[model samples]
Target: MEHVAKTRDRITLTGVRVRAHHGVFDFEREAGQEFVIDVSVAVDLAAAASGDDLARTVHYGELAEAISAAVERDPVDLIETVAERVASVALAFPAVEEVEVTVHKPQAPITVPFTDVAVTIVRGRA
Candidate 1:
């Protein structure tokens, strides 16, 4: 079987804010924290653009909701796990050929002052 390249067209959702309890320290998880996420999906836009049908493409609203739900679930020790979970969620959409997920934890428990901590992952269909 021949493999087709994914379309360059990308649909992105940024700054998806959610509060979840994910951390290694007991206090950290007990207090909970805010996580910001960004997601991008690559898919063929010809059908959706030409036909103007919602069924032909992945819905941004639905995608955001899915990401939010995924993050708000059970706690994990690392943002890497969250990123992987989000990538899996994005790949579940039939039209998504490739997905990039970024999970950010701004309020991480660091002794030194820092701006943010994040993990990014890219996944594609086989």
Candidate 2:
């Protein structure tokens, strides 16, 4: 069984679309495709809520751009790596305690028909 992170105030960015080259096949690497990324970051928002200060919380706009850049920055062979990379970025925020990332590959090359394929991972500080 996998461990689930404890509940906390979350900032979710879903359906963030980015085009990238990531796959095991040569064609997949050469011909990039669109990837939809979903990220949920767990952080302490009590200060921000009480103080009404943006500085006390994670900025969703900046975080979304950071996640997108991580996805489009390098060409990896697996979405699992991409998910980990996103999680790492999220965990860098001072207020973030845990992160969950989902990398969606809609144009995967498979013989049979499929809607999508993805990898979801959860990570936190050690």
Candidate 3:
């Protein structure tokens, strides 16, 4: 008798941060600052594991590119919006069942220097 290992059914990514400019302040939008983003997606990887098909798995490269594009394409007033957009993009993949996005602004022009400022959002397919 032969035993076969069951393939994992979920996919997760973490610490996917990028630098960009996103803020409501005029200086932030004009001067261009650095913003970091972390994202994770719950996806079904069984198909890809069984069939060895790239299409069956969510491509991290593409996901990263999409996030980068979104961050660079426009300037928003809030990190909440950035988180929402990143989560939305992650959910666009058919294999992704749910997504979590966190946007960090480390260099926010606050009155005092802080460790970091960030926003996290989660979204799922209905």
Which candidate has the highest lDDT of all? 1
Better of 1 and 2 by TM-score: 1
1-126 in candidate 1: lDDT tens per residue? 999665899999999999999999998689999999999999888999999988999999999999999999999999999999999999999999999999999999888999998989999988
Find the candidate with the highest TM-score and give its number: 1
Candidate ordering by lDDT (highest first): 1, 2, 3
lDDT of 1: 0.94
lDDT string, candidate 2, 17-83, tens digits: 9999999999989999999999999888889999999999999999999999999988999999999
Worst 10 residues of 2 by lDDT: 4-13
Off by over 4 Å in 1: 1-3
Every model's TM-score: 0.95, 0.93, 0.84
Q: How do the residues 21-77 of candidate 3 rate in per-residue lDDT, one tens digit apiece?
A: 678888887887777878878766767879999998988889888888887767788
Worst 10 residues of 3 by lDDT: 4-13
Each prediction's Cα lDDT score? 0.94, 0.92, 0.78
Comparison by lDDT, 1 against 2, better one: 1
Clash pairs, model 2 backbone: none
Clashing residue pairs in all predictions, respectively, total: 0, 0, 1
lDDT of 1 at 38: 97
All candidates: CA RMSD in angstroms?
Answer: 1.3, 4.0, 5.3
